[model samples]
Target: MSNFKITDIVGVIPALITPFDENENFDEGRMRNVVDFLIEEGVHGFYLTGSTGEGFLMTPDERKKVVKVVVDQVNGRVPVIAHIGAISTKISIDLAKDAYETGVDAISSVPPFYWKFKDNNIFKYYEDLSGSTPLPMIVYNVPLAGLFGFDFIKRLSTIENVKGIKYTAYTHQDIHKAKAQIGKDFMVYSGADEMAVSGLFNEADGIIGSFYSMLADVYVDIYNNIKAGEFSKAQIKQKIAVDIIEASLKYDYYAVIKAAMKWMGFDGGYVRRPFNNLSSCEEEKVKDEFRKIRDRYGVEDIRVLKSI
Candidate 1:
């Protein structure tokens, strides 16, 4: 049987960033605090080691460490989806199996990149990894992975235990078509942080985003508003998120977030090598704008929420 029931996965799941120390090592303490903060904020689920989490940069051992830390910290309060994508099929399968054993609610992977392959090969990659673990597998489809379109999604969705796709693009019509073709139960999570409400309008089951790590309450508000048939309110929340995201893009996006987390009194550490940390001047600007974001949104001081 599949490890994760389809209904168990939904809503504003944050694609959590990995906390790293000055020495460029994973910082467990910082990670724990972030997890506690997110759960306390009422985020529906957690997505670890994805693009925003720098999963692509981490070694297999490092990825496993992240999974263990997050899963233990969460302790079944909500679902945790682990992204275990590697360029090699064997590595992806091994990571999938390891994440399953480490207790993630589901596993996700990006298609093979930096090399050309037939559609059949891509399908085989997902097919092998999906069967390697009972945990449901989510396909990460973005332009970076060649944007497996709706028809391909229909085929991929047929894989045993392949539960869904983290649809990262803005093609809402295709998302609508895929849902109609495959039936409503096939999960479609919006990975595009900016157009989140649009995704839901097109019938995405929920949203999984990196920005939600900081503005989860806003995203959750958007989700709840949509569910309550409050489209206008949902659009308002979406605009707030877009504004914050626009501000975050001012510098290195991940670096800005790490800086923002620190400003909020959470233990957001540093980004690893090759991804430059923000310069001091840029960081101050981000902090200044982040405060504006909170002010504009009328959000409470999240730092006062108390860390676990």
Candidate 2:
């Protein structure tokens, strides 16, 4: 019966992956299983249909279905933030409206890709999208969408419904500066999974990353360790996190994450076209390597991870 407020949107929020069946259709059951898995693992929140979820590649209908299924499966256990960003303001608005009506706790968006829009144009895109719904908006700043400069980020913080920014850059100073410039009430979720310890130590309220779908407990451990003022222990956990991340990156990222999940008995089915899942031989190789990573990091099962 508990629900999270904007201020409560902190800690290990997984950047959830979009599961597809062998036929490349949205596998609702597998998606639902992923939702339930994260919840049981004690994730603090869920970011649906973001980069990790392949939102950009999905049709509007697929995106909506994902949001609906995740929100329904989550059933108010924690906050569900949907990523509704698209190539144009109109599409983003439509997706935003759908996400809002589908009962997401909030909406987040990356800037328009494949074009060099001026700063004002980019600002207007977010402004228009934020105005499309009452749901709070978190600006997603990643390299692919053009990095959001501090000036632009500061301007965005002033937007009426703009709640926060998902900082994905390599610098921890950006997190610190955003907090100082935007004021403490504005939430900043570290989108880089490997830098979670740095983000938390620099005062990021939470973390949202693709890796967390399988590694939630370890990130939660880092969060808790940092919050408890156990920096030494948190540093050790962060090292473990980086190690896991490095292992996953050796292959196709989404493919590797999905394969790792599959290895743990969760249904991370084939990735859609334009991005292929591991072949039989590659899967066997990656699985053998991941097993070592898992054993070293103590990643047994998602369901067994201690909850926050």
Candidate 3:
């Protein structure tokens, strides 16, 4: 059985961006660097192969490789929650087993999407997948998938080993209600990057989002400030984060994130195919905007941008 309790997965957990090579291949070396960089920046845990990681774009084997590399690199320094959600129960089960063997602290899955499965079917999916491995199970409640509701979450929570929910919707009210109804033992990580401050104030156990991968220290500060009752300080950081996100949203989200990381001196390569890449001119514009945001917000000067 997994030694990690639900509480161990709390705090600023980044839904990591999967690094790729020019040929769109998974780059192990770059992946390790991303992992090490985030750990050094003080993130509490990692959620691998999720939407931000382009989990659905890669083959199952590629996903497994990514998880193995991260788990090996992490070396138990912090908890690693592998996103093994697939449309098929068998596939998710297989991935969960592999995640257990690879030593992840927990496993999470987006309820099977693409088909309009009923609540019962969804519950069955969680039941089989969570029971397949001893690792703590975190249900990914992404409303965009159209399968999420508080009632569904409560039902899933009853499953053996199902311990938490990565609540990715914008409804902070649901987060507050879940905490009150589900009890503190059920971990509810706020998965909306733009709402980090609101989520925490509403009683989310922690924050997990795509932006956290790019701005780990900033979000870490936000979490710390809130915990310390420094609401004003946390709001300042959250505003900076919002500004960055607004700028990036003007371009292809994944492409611009990779581009920004490159400008920061960490070349995470490009977003994989089926996702558009930023043109040369577009890349430069994004770089300029990002630099301005960084300077305006006084984002820490640890990156190579200071020298540039």
User: At residue 240, what lDDT does model 2 achieve?
Assistant: 67
* Candidate maximizing TM-score: 3
Off by more than 4 A, model 1: 1-4, 291-308
**C-alpha TM-scores of all predictions:** 0.93, 0.93, 0.94
For candidate 2, list the clashing residue pairs, or say none. Answer: none
Could you tell me how far off, in angstroms, the CA of residue 75 lies in candidate 1 after the best superposition?
A: 0.6
Alpha carbon deviation, residue 13, candidate 2 (Å): 0.6
lDDT of 1 by residue, 212-232 (tens): 887777788889999999999
Model 3 residue 68 distance off true place after TM-score fit, in angstroms: 0.6
* Candidate 1 vs candidate 3, lDDT winner: 3
Please give the lDDT score for candidate 2. 0.83
Model 1: lDDT of residue 245: 87
If ranked by lDDT, best first, what sequence of candidates would result? 3, 1, 2
